[model samples]
Target: MSIPHGAASAAARPDRVDPAVRRIGATLVVGALGVVFDTTVVSVALDDLAKAFDAPLATVQWVSTGYLLAVFVTIPLAVWAQARFGGRRLWIAALGGFLLGSVLSALAWNATSLIVFRVVQGLAGGIMMPLMATLLMQAARGSHPGRVMAIITVPTALGPILGPVLGGLVLHLADWRWMFFVNIPFCVVGGWLALRNLPDDRPEPGGPRGRLDVVGLLLLCPGVAALVYGLSRVEGGAGTTGAAVLVPLLGGLALVGGFTARSLTRPGGALIDLRLFRHRAVASSAALLFLGGIALYGPMMLLPLYFQQVRGEDALGAGLALIPQGVGALLARALAGRYMDRVGPRRVAVTAFALVAVATVPFAFVTAGTGGAVLMAALFVRGIALGAAMIAPMGAAYVGLRHQEIPDAGVITRVAQQIGGSVGIALLAVVLQHAAAGAHGPSALAGAFDRAFWWSAVLTALAVPLCLLLPGRPEPPPPARTTRTGEAVDPRRPTV
Candidate 1:
């Protein structure tokens, strides 16, 4: 259900992060960093994998593709897994799976083995990311969303900034295996924290477990994975019309359509409750995030390629140049969260999306000789818009949700953003391919990127109007307890 604007007056939502929030937030962030870094960090090592395995580029690409499919396919299982084993247990187990996969991947002797191991990593990672958000939000209990989100977003903001740099450095220094090796410390520490800090809430003291939603899983899992697989194929010379693209793309759609129909029939029992979308916040936020995935991911691809191809910078140089954007993203969180609580996500999302579109205009006008300082400043501003833009909708999605509802919300939003990302990358790849068809110079490549940036700006612009549909001000926190005699009573509940 949509949380009415009046539910949380200006007086209700706190602007500051609480001390308890800080403790859990820190722990969750630490555990989540491994997944974030591992995902982005591996992108820069694809070429190394191909060479090391003496395999075709397409074959080596599965190191990433297989992981992606596995992530999507396994994501649907998260709701069921969390409910069956409890969040704490599921989190620890997933982290353990990821850690084991990382170790096995680092030890693999062949590309096929590495690809198989990556699937394990993806399955674990897909669950962890959504579960991380769900656990943290439930802990927050609808207070200080801005502050809570700021801490949660650190990994995301840091990933783009550090992942490529870290990946490049690893390839230059040690070897590709270290990419997987680096995840060890994070997993070990995260697991330790889970064991120590997280509350254990086993279902009914190990009585009969929740019935598995077998039909929903069968429909939703492959359905989403198929869609992403289709998009991945769309980027190559095959194009959207080719059999390679159309078969899975259309087939995935049919399956998903069927899943939606099936979910409608299952109510609370569906793996992901489709009824949740009836709330304006969830549905609208999902839409904006869908577009956001395109705007953000599409431009992310263009930015690095732009610097390297147009400016003739090395990978390290491009990473360094993009540092300003990362800084902006990190800096925006504190302010964005505060304002989101104060003015509400609707207003903040509108302004932020517009700002993103405006900031992108400069990149859309780039030239071969464009000054680095000028472009850097624009990127910094764009990052600021992006940081706020991402947080507002994310916080809004959970505004009126009951505790149990958060798991489904998490899965829905993750799937939306993930599929949106795949769509963005595929579309931009096609556009870039066409624009560079006859181009032969740095100037020509710059033009191709300019066109792509325009597409990104248009995407952000498109999301602006939809901000109106986000949840209003977070419902004011519940008032303090009172006794029959009007004496104050503690509302404090047992730590869960």
Candidate 2:
């Protein structure tokens, strides 16, 4: 009846990371980039996918939606998989699975088939993203996390900014299939590196690694999948009636709630560590991530529409216009990371949120006749603010968590962000629909978009105070010592 608090062995050697660990970290980043690249690539390629399959836009949209829902379904399984199979093996397997799925997707001929293949990719992707975090954080157990996190997050920070750009470029010259093909080399290299360099951090003796939680997976996966499905439906003109939306949504809630109750009573490391919720920092980080998700992605949906609908730009032209935002985001990541290290999550998050609020204000003033110069400047500022805001709070969430706990945090933050995006998209869609209902011309649609921007700005502002709640400066790294056998040992073990 006792909880296994000593989940990883305390006496294990933990000294300076070997060259192998460093190599593995770099390889994981490459693999991580490939995952993000695929995610962004599909966003840019949706139209092409639909056209190629001769499917309706609504149906084809599930290609992305299904992939995301599949991610949610698979994420909780990472903890169990890692405990049973070891982090190295699981990661290499995930990368291989992703590569295989990408190949299948590229070869798919119909929208339905592509969606199914995308789901396969998503399931594997879901495992990789969090496991990457888990493994890195665990490896850096006795090290300075600020520096380690900075190194790990570079690609994640770059992915959003670059994904669209790369996706656009691919669409311009090569076919959509090339995006999937691109992942092949990265996966092969990543797998090889994982096999060669990834550390072997096995579960402690007597740690929970028994039968799979069949009932839990059934409830949890479907629950999350249904909720995301419902949200995606909201954007597909299924306002309330054309909606089979409520069915999955309500069912999802019930399943999640049921599984949660079961997890609390059953055993160690419940699909997600519900114990993490007890931490105020984790809870607040999740809430802010939800709001930040809205700020980050909601405008993405609106901006492209404004460019095409009001500014009369083609897809390529619109992509070009978005370049400034990406450039600004790329420029801000390092500075933001360094600041987060020095001043802690609170100051960094608050400052970043303020900048985001200020930057987003310009969107409220956008008009049909607004000059491209002014809009570009606004987007640039917004991008910089977005970059800082995104990384600061993410760093904050793991401020005090131990090595093994980081994976759970990754799942938590990711799910929070995605769910937030779904809500933001649906809410903004409805708001714009209502806002645009009153008029018939370009000016009217512009006015509707402006209204949406104002709301998004308000949402960004609301997160500022929450950011203030994040913990101040991180603790110093643990000290390392050596035993007669020459294995590194953590000095903090006795104290814990």
Candidate 3:
């Protein structure tokens, strides 16, 4: 049995990534950092914002809640917007909107105003997140997906690491308003680079621009927002059966179910083509991403709280303690990207998920007196596995997708991960609360976190087998040919 030429070449040199792809990824990351960073940074500032406005914490919580709801509302619109407008135009427009929102938020006079302004930021950010991946993957033309995804995910990786630390620093030295003001540099630089680097891809004049499915939009936007809102309410210590949680959750599920039915019946004209679920890569990746979200975000809530409530660290100290996990995630990126491309997503995803579960086990046994070095070591390993776990599925979702299909896939995957995160946080929050009910000492609190961490570990482990459903080792690339000037050109590369 002879090895295929493409396979041999791929084996020989798996790290070949295009310079243009790198440029595009760099440009997108600059803008995306603001969105990702803002979400995490603001998370730490909600308390401060409440104090600044002399408002009740519940009222001020809307500043973050409103932003999240707005994001859900606009997420489904990205595919249509990018189709109606070019990617370049949409990128700049969204950046401009975020910049405006940031400015307004910084100047907000009250909680209500800040909430409204954050909604503006969310609307713009919702578009950029999916568009960033769609643009990069389309540019890569199905080649080097893992590497491209690594570049695409730079902001996500950095957000967890830097957002809180930056937030803590800002609050220590400045006012809460500076949190929004800090977004100015990212927006300005991102907008400028986007103009220069991104290709103008507006739909051709008189081309068949599909009509926006207003019905589908109406069903999905509010459905997703309601779902997220309900879950967030749960995170705020409300029970699942509470009116605030159940009303929105059931309503959201009903609306989303309606959208799903409508989309399945009218795939061609729907806001998001539900038919993409037919693809094995898309379907499996979506399922795994849901689990990955729980594994990632559920513990995220517990880690900081464990540090604060059980270990007696302040906000800044808690944030600083998480630095090791971030460092591990960073270190895993390059290696994970390379191997995901070379060996494929399935093996990597399974191995990574298993490792994540294993790493999480130490936390399940956490005690008030657990050594800091030991816990940090566990977090570092968990971070590495989590990073690879995310990169694998994200890159896999795009496998075998066409240029036009990329945006829809992007939207589906993003929504899945996000909703999954909401679910994770809510469920974990409930668990922690129930386990710690009436607890007074740090020792008792540590035991409650242990139970919650156990749930996180079990949830993560469930995905290990599901990862087998992901696409196996990538097929060999098509052969490269030399141009007239002897420049090697990949025949598979997209000219668009």
Total backbone collisions for each predicted model: 3, 1, 0
lDDT score for candidate 1 against the true structure: 0.82
Best candidate according to lDDT: 3
Candidates sorted on TM-score, descending: 3, 1, 2
Instruction: Name the regions of candidate 2 deviating beyond 4 angstroms.
Output: 1-22, 202-210, 240-242, 265-269, 485-488, 492-496
- Provide the lDDT at 342 for model 3: 91
TM-score of each: 0.93, 0.89, 0.95
- Cα deviation at 396, candidate 2, in Å, is 2.0
**Model 1 CA lDDT for position 206:** 44
Tens digits of lDDT, candidate 2, 61-117: 888888888888888888788878888889988998999999999899899999999
Model 3 stretches astray by more than 4 angstroms: 1-15, 480-496
TM-score computed on alpha carbons, candidate 3? 0.95
After TM-score superposition, the amount by which residue 276's alpha carbon in candidate 3 deviates from its true location, in angstroms, is 0.7
Error of 1 at 304 (Å): 1.4
Residue-pair clashes, model 3: 0
**Cα lDDT listed for each candidate:** 0.82, 0.77, 0.88
Show the colliding residue pairs in model 3.
none
Local accuracy of candidate 3 as per-residue lDDT tens digits, 270-296: 899989999999999999999988988
Best by TM-score: 3
